[model samples]
Target: MEPRLTNPAGLLPDVGQAVNILYKSAHTAGVPGSVLELVHLRASQINGCGPCVDHGARAMRKAGETDDRLFAVAVWRETPYFTEPERAALALAEYATRLADRPDAVPDAIWDEAAKHFSEKELAAIVLWIATTNFFNRLNVTTRQQAPANY
Candidate 1:
């Protein structure tokens, strides 16, 4: 799709930089970058935002993620491709992204499951990444940001 805006975030010069700082801050926290990529891909897939999904997959591939794992991200619950930690993270991403689906979004069960795998700091980072990916998904979908090329 053609972009609806040349530089939607550019209207405010510091927007991109601000987002970058927050993203960088999250990266520096306890969660590994590789796992965060999976969270991003899963969340983007749920949002049906092509640009974020494309970018997330490319990020994973660049980090040496296998095709099997990459393809399994969307159906993580049914696949054997992920570890328990990854599954917990993906679950957190799903519930957080689709908050309106249930009355108690990010219910205690999912949060407790994630807590079983991650430290409080690590959980914070995963959550930040989830929130950030959702933000970008809405922005890209709203502005019709196209993927660099169809994959």
Candidate 2:
């Protein structure tokens, strides 16, 4: 679908910069770049934001992630490709993204699993990453942002 208009980031430079700053903070929060990409890709897939999914995959690949693991992110539970920590992060991403589907968004069990793997600071970073990706996903989906042809 065609975008409804030019990307809002271009139209509102200040807002775009603010988002960029927030995104940068997440990157420095000590979470691994690879994990963050997985979280971003899973959330984008669930939100059906093609641009994000494309960008996330490319970013993951650039960080040295393999195609098989990236392809199996959607079926993480069925695959033996991920470590326990990765599984926790993916579960957190799914639960957080599907908040409206349940009353207790991000149930304790999921949080507990994640806690077992990530330190408190890393957990906070993961939460922020999930929230940030969701924000971008909603914006892209609403604007009908399409992935570049080369993506």
Candidate 3:
């Protein structure tokens, strides 16, 4: 599909830069980049943001991720490709991205599981990553941004 408009971040470069800064800082808390990638891909998938999902998966693959893991990401719960920490992060991404689907957006059990897998700092970073992904997902979906032809 053609985009409804240029990416808002592109039209407003400062907004893009601000998001880039947030993304960079989100990596400072020691959560593995792999886990962050999973979070991004899962959230984008949930939001039906084809552009973000395409870009995220391409980035992961370019970084040497295996097809097995990438293919199983959408069905991570039934797959053995991800580690426990990765699973926890994916779960958090799902619950957080679907906040409107439930009254208790992020239930304590999910947060506690993520906490058990990640330190406070790591959890902060993970949440930041999730929030950032959601922001981009909304932007892309709202604009009808198209995925790359090759994706």
Report the number of the highest-TM-score candidate. 3
lDDT winner, 1 or 3: 3
Question: How many clashes (backbone N, Cα, C below 3 Å) per candidate?
Answer: 0, 0, 0
* Tens digits of per-residue lDDT for model 1, 8-70: 676778888989987997898878888899899999999999888988898889889999999
Q: Would you estimate the TM-scores of all the predictions?
A: 0.94, 0.95, 0.96
Write down the lDDT that model 3 would get: 0.93
Query: What C-alpha lDDT do the candidate models reach, one value each?
Result: 0.89, 0.90, 0.93
lDDT of 2: 0.90
Best by lDDT: 3
- Give the C-alpha miss distance for residue 105 in model 3, angstroms: 0.7
Ten contiguous residues with the weakest lDDT in model 3: 142-151
TM-score of 1: 0.94
Candidate 3 lands at a TM-score of 0.96
Off by over 4 Å in 2: none
